[model samples]
Target: MKNKQEIPAVIVADAKVFDYLKEKVGERKTRTEAYSDLLDKSLAGFISPFLRKQDYDLQPCQCHVTISDLATEWHWHRATVRSFLETLEAFGQLKRTRLAKSIVITMPVQSGQSSATFVIQRQPDFAIQLQEVLSDWIVGKTTSADVGNLCGQVVHQAMTGMTGYESRHCPDSHIDTASAHAGKQEEEIRKTALGCIAHAALQRVLWKSRFDDSSPLIEFFRHDLDEEWVSFIEASKELAELILDTEACETTFDTDDDKERLKSLRKPFLSLLARTQEPAD
Candidate 1:
């Protein structure tokens, strides 16, 4: 869990997709373009207050955007926009603060997201420390300049090292084998318990808020991610929500520097998370 985490920001306002959105006005919009447009709208000109509270302490790239506003902008249904924002938060791409009925997102750019947080030192596993970013790079959830960039670097590092690769299968002693296998099994069990705890915590929060039913979390993952990755991503999203709660929900900036310092501090792990199967990045 301690690794060099990355938040992809390859999305931009300039793309053929941008032209497509304009050409097909009032038509469907891709997650990429919708995110770009949202950032653009938040930075410039006054975005009319559509929330219950007209007064917002918003900064350059921070604003309170209603699902309705996003739907109209992207020509999509309100439900679609709301679902996308929730997905973005799951991927840790959006800095969000959930309100009574609205959400505030602080989408910062450049050095605004830097942080100086303490990182837990990891125990050695003879694993190569080759990492710059780790993500599935889904089109809308996130993007990358080249999805294969990290893989190439990993190969390069291994080939350049004393050994092309290091996978020695020395037989483990009985005690060692038992410990390792038991630990692996326990880890899985703990993750399951954690995922349930996270899901229930979210549901309880919504229930207290008078939400009739808050089951979007269950529904979204059923379609967005592979079945195996559901618990992983959900747990990660809950962790992100907790981190967001420690920061300013939304605020007015006295200066650009002041705003930059207030940007989301996404401190990744000290080591890359181990992938046992498909996410073999």
Candidate 2:
């Protein structure tokens, strides 16, 4: 058995591959268990010749295949095959290079031509969490609200415009416009506000559950807050900490106190309401 400190060849080959797996399967398993389970499933092609035959066809001359060709030949969904190919690339098992022309199809001809082909080099021992999340969203088990929350989090990291006091880049145009139109006929803005409040509350509860106590909101504040919301950004961290600490108190509040607390929270968010309520300026 290898020591836990020892680096596995699989991980060394592609660190991104392991990150992909951890993001999908989660951080619960022991290192050995993660290695064995991911490696065993990913390397099944080498262990089972029949399974390999079922999934891929070996050709003496052919070095590259289109994603669609592999999907049709193996009787697998195109998206599934593409996902596996991505995993292989991530793990350093495969190097995918985009090809311009259509390759010969061993299976029955599909109506459409494939846009690109990939060179299958080495199969990776990891998978993609984004694809998994998308699959879950498609299956109806995950709600639109969950999808929105996850997208918001990812966008928060990758892009600056979507989060914090300077949320001009957040993708709220369509929703905001629809909300405005709905406001004329009914209380759409109120409903939207309620939903945002509920989501914020849920996030607070989840944070408390994980930390056993409230986390300092300053820890999650966006670094770009200062750049965009210049005036408010200076004090945003202090304000956020105050809000979080106030919200974290154990005792339930009466209606008056609840209203007052909400009024306080709304004050900060309202400073940017003009920007958020209007179309991206």
Candidate 3:
């Protein structure tokens, strides 16, 4: 078996010259270009508009999308869309939040902290998080958009020393009705930066005890975070620390009861968890 430290790192290429060359060469997309394009679309949420009903599960063009919608938009087979997403997800280059009918693609853009990798692992999906607030639209359907910094670069690097920031160029968002909206973007991230940092502390505590059989904290990492799960995590901090924390949880009546308590916590969120179909390892 390989040492845990032997894990390989994933590269996040800047969206620049490489794609320009690809476009000049041909219209057909390689898997590399497809992932690039998908990322680009999500980043370009300024124009994507919130055309659907006000379901808390949906984010505005501020970078939320359905798989069927994206496949049609890209003119690719749905299988093709799923394949690219699954591949990217496994590499940790992108994140996919699977909903009842469509998958919410996060992480085409990551910038200042409001959130981790987009807000927690090197997973940078906060691009939309900023836009949602900047544009004042119902953003990223994250159940706990309040926990915007749950998985952020500040949180990730502080927790694991990984460079979780994804610095892509922002689209033409003119809140001042001008060119770039950099000022406002930075402003809002500051507001949420503290929350992101606090969550990082929580993440660090969770990571230290991930292997403890009696602890279920690792469930956050094992499963893709949905809106419901996020809210559940934030809803009761002291309760979570007592029940989910490794040291705290181990002080149970017994292992069986410990598991039962863990199950109780999971039951509320399993609706989305059970329905989720992440790309296989």
Candidate 4:
């Protein structure tokens, strides 16, 4: 038997087969394990080293073609192509449709093979179109601003469009009024904006919290700002009191504590602005 390293090296050199293997087995595993699994499944044996003429016998000429035609054109096995088609459909890129057969194939003698025709439909590439539309929107509105402002604009556009759709097509008459749509849209926008602001605020705090001799709470804040900020502030307060207890001199404002306090205060400032802003403007 060939050495384990030699087998995987041979398989990995073929770009097409290597990519397929990598997709099946993630990047974290050893190459030997991936090759062993492929060999065990008989996939390695079935893979053709060179294209065969029969592979293109029933290929389609159009850009929009059936799964069977794609399989033939790409020289992929029928079952593998079927699996790929199913995955694409799940991702909303393809649609499948059925057609009634106008003619049937009859075998001369008792044969095991049976044949049927299926019609395949391809969805309009909405995912790519949506990405392009969003890119254009952002490009037109691009400006130098803080992260919070950028995130706010993106969220506003997405929520407004989604709310417009909800208003037009909502089936429940009781919940379909203009006021209800506006209220729900505002609530959603507020939640999303607040979440973004919180993230930005926490990021600023984390960046400042890092020093030559940082506390564990400060380190934790850097790693997990959302969950650790409250605890960090509480611990900072406790530390402030400890300093106060030890010092007998007159109270003098500490710059570090003042900065930490200001960092904690930015969230409420953004929240107030968000609450006061009108949706129409």
Candidate 5:
């Protein structure tokens, strides 16, 4: 185990880190002041090397912090402090447990956290795309009330695009009603399957934004996402590239083989989509 003195400067000091801290602090504080304050507050009595080596669930980290103390120290709202702490826990940057009266936080080994590599992309076009897509699906052009309605509309469009099928009526030539019913069922299945494909495409677009260790998306959606979501976000960039490749395929018509290959590739995304669904009554 490396002592604090032996810890590399690369991990301990960076000018960019102070900029990030300043942004999170969200007040009039300058970068220098933020850095100085952060050092004063967080570094003293910080978790030691021995604490990191212990089994956290059995022998928790020695650092115990209250949310109110953090809120006051950081000049942030109590709710914001709570959310930030939860995000840290989700990222494996810290461990949090609830006691009978208060919350206990345990700082994790920072060296382990340095292993993640982040790729940042510049997304100048996504804001326009999101607005356009949302505009197309939502009606009644303007109202504060309608802003609340947009969430449902976006979800509804995704679900509709995923499950919509053109229902076919029985033809006179097909005298068998049972055969007609089976045909309808098959059509429904096809529609539902195609909807899943569309939903995957939507996801590829939605989360394909720029992300780094310092992204605010981590803070905002932190409650719903975890460190594992980072991998999914990274994979979506590759998925977007694959989508471009498929679109540019020279074949005018897709063969059964191509269809099966696409289905196999999308299986994981479809499974994730299933997990996101609300349980039915």
Candidate 6:
């Protein structure tokens, strides 16, 4: 086993990198949570070269990483850490092989596409939880879109509670234009905050399809954040560009009348779920 102590001390590639993570992850995550997430990304980058050598035509972009080493470095439970890795694999973010006690992780991307990076929100940590939920929903072999629809419902359920205020105000139509026509500032503020959170969650789900870092919706990571959190942020131009280039797909599912508003997000939810089942080639 590699010496856990020898795992290079966490170093900031760019002090400003953290700011981007914070922005992407949202205020829903604590600085500690955000820092830990950034550290993982940093460690993954450090481990990438080693992983590249293990890449195979059948299992490309592979690397050997021990659960103990990760748990020790991250000060997390071994089981929890293992669960997270398994969840990543389950989500098709990576593939894992157990070589004795050591874990070999493979990125299922093409050699030329190795530059691709994936982001997922670690705080709400919904990926793994949602993966498990979908497992039950996926009774038999199903399409990625089907699983995605189920995942979308889960997201819709999560954001549903936040919309209570909006429902009380509009009752019939929660659309911003409807509320805007009525012109109520309190309702608008509530709706905007809720919208931001819902949108962030939806965006995170969509990004998951592309296999990049995914974060929950909260607030945009500000470039001018305190130096303490500076290492968390990364430039968002690429992510922003990706979002612009990608179009959202909508799906429909049966729901109570109250949840009719969530139908529009079916495409995004399905998109996230579908990405996980994408061809491994």
The runs of at least 3 residues in candidate 1 whose Cα sits more than 4 Å from the true structure, single-residue gaps closed, are 1-26, 49-53, 111-281
Question: Is candidate 1 or 4 superior in TM-score?
Answer: 1
Question: Given candidate 1, what's the lDDT at residue 103?
Answer: 67
* Model 6: worst 10 consecutive residues (lDDT sum): 114-123
Per-residue lDDT tens digits for candidate 5, residues 202-225, read 544433321212233234235434
Give each model's whole-structure lDDT: 0.42, 0.36, 0.44, 0.36, 0.39, 0.42
Q: Model 6, which residues run further than 4 Å from truth?
A: 1-19, 22-60, 109-111, 114-281
Better of 4 and 5 by TM-score: 4
Best by TM-score: 1
lDDT of 4 by residue, 1-281 (tens): 94544210100123244445554333333333323332322322232223222232211211123435444544555555555444333323334332231111111111121110100111122222222223323333423253334455455554455556555655566454645655665664455345434433433343343332333444445654556767657644544454335353224336766546534544443343233221211
Better of 3 and 5 by lDDT: 3
The clash numbers for all candidates, in the given order, read 5, 4, 21, 0, 1, 26
Give the per-residue lDDT digits (tens) of candidate 2, residues 1-281: 94655321211234344455553334334333334333433333222322333334433222345656555544556655555554334423334444453222121111133211111111122122223333345445667697656544432332221112123322576556533433332232223223444443443333333423222222223442333556346445434444467565334344665445443543434333222222111
Which should have the higher lDDT, number 1 or number 3?
Answer: 3
Write the residue-wise lDDT of candidate 1 on 61-170 in tens digits. Answer: 67677677777867777766766676444433456777666667865432232111000001010011211232223212224445346534433432322121111222
- What are the TM-scores, per candidate, against the unseen true structure? 0.36, 0.21, 0.34, 0.28, 0.26, 0.28
Q: Model 5 segments beyond 4 Å from truth? A: 1-43, 46-61, 110-281
- In model 2, the Cα lDDT at residue 94 comes to 37
